[model samples]
Target: MGDGLLVFDGRCGFCTRSVGWARALDRRGRVEMRPYQEPGVPESIGTDAATCSEAVQWQGRDGVRLEGAAAVNALLDTVSGTRIPSTVYRVTGGLQERVYRWVADHRSRFPGMTPYCESHPAECAS
Candidate 1:
């Protein structure tokens, strides 16, 4: 695995949990996960913060990018315990995007997210 940056919504509990899981699985120490709220995150990737607000973004070492479900797949490819997801992504065409969108759209209702958002009311909508 090579170095890359994964920018995600730090306020969302689901996203935070997913990031932790990925980080634990990424034994190669190749991927670095950063929250959208982090200073200079968007600038470092040459994109606006609004894009990170919309979906997880993966900035490859060579400046390539993968957004939303594509970003998840790319990160999973680098993690050892995520082979099934990578395989499903490779064969499923747009399925991953649909699933990712559905989950992202309904993230507010997810367990742990509601309580986590109490500290930041604005991020609940994110």
Candidate 2:
């Protein structure tokens, strides 16, 4: 209901591009995006590097945690007023989770994808 945080793999090109799109849709700035690789980010978000590496993490202002497809649905809920996507994900009987996992597993194979660190060198700089 209030502000939310989305923790993602900063080095992933697909993940970065997806977050970029989400940022554009978030006109209200309800969600904040952070790279798990960033120093102290995982600890600050109450998540560990291993968990974040497996799936995107979303922490609601209410302190509820969601990961993978659920996490994406939560972000979508914030940027858009409609709950149709979440509903669809729920009714699909784990299909959404499977799809999310597939994408995560093969993210690097996507054609034309570039790692965020490579595309945005300055941003990834330590």
Candidate 3:
């Protein structure tokens, strides 16, 4: 019901593009974004860095937490004038998660940061 914070992978180019899209759509600036890798962020978000690394996360002013596609839906919730579409998208949990997982699985192929994962390929594989 208040400000929404989205924590995402800053190093991934794909993730960066996605954040830009969200920001562009939300003209009201209702959503704020921060990289999960930022210091003191995970603690503030009531999560750990490891979990945030795996998927996106969201925190509402009411203290509700959502992850992955659900976190995305939370961001979408503040598009200024897309309530119905957002509700519909939010309700489809299974489909959203499947799509999110698929994208995450292939993040390197998407429009994102370079060197998606150098030291550990598995880090970007999932």
Candidate 4:
């Protein structure tokens, strides 16, 4: 892979936390994170930053794009070569996708989420 681009909502508390976790797991910085709101991002892989704030995305080698579960899986692929236990998350499939959607949809109601969102509501995309 040229480099893994993890497009995520920079304003989301959960998203920020996850990014921190991933960064810690891959201290070499193999994955590059770009806020979906960045200007000039290509739309071919669904790069509408505002809209994509509600989803997960990962662009892999050869421009293979994965969303939701597959996106999470692709990110794991980058750390697989390291000491990270990739197999531990083998089941991030359909079920996980549904759960992800649910949490994302209702994230505003989650504890500590309101304060986080209030601090960056402009980027939260409602």
Every model's Cα RMSD, please? 4.3, 2.4, 5.6, 4.4
lDDT of 1 by residue, 32-115 (tens): 887777777777888887888889999877788889998888787766545676677879849879988899888767764433
If the candidates were sorted by their lDDT against the true structure, best first, what order would they fall in? 2, 1, 3, 4
The window of 10 residues in a row where model 2 has the poorest summed lDDT is 117-126
List model 4 lDDT by residue over 19-102, tens digit each. Answer: 667778766677876656555443645567655776878887568777766677678778555324235445546677788788
Between prediction 1 and prediction 3, which has the larger TM-score? 3
The TM-scores of all predictions, comma-separated, are: 0.79, 0.86, 0.81, 0.70
Q: What stretches of model 1 exceed 4 Å from their correct place?
A: 81-87, 113-126
Q: Write the per-residue lDDT of candidate 2 for residues 38-86, one digit (tens) a residue.
A: 7777887787888999999999888988999999998898789677767
The local lDDT score (0 to 100) that residue 82 gets in candidate 4 is 38
Task: Point out where model 4 deviates above 4 Å.
Answer: 42-46, 82-92, 110-126
Which lDDT tens digits does candidate 3 get at residues 1-126?
247888888677788778878889988878878777667777788999899989999998788888998888777876655566457775788898999999898988876544324323444333
Compared with the true structure, model 4 gives a TM-score of 0.70
Higher-TM-score candidate among 3 and 4? Answer: 3
Clash number for model 1?
0
Give the winner by lDDT. 2
Count of steric clashes across candidates, in order: 0, 0, 6, 0
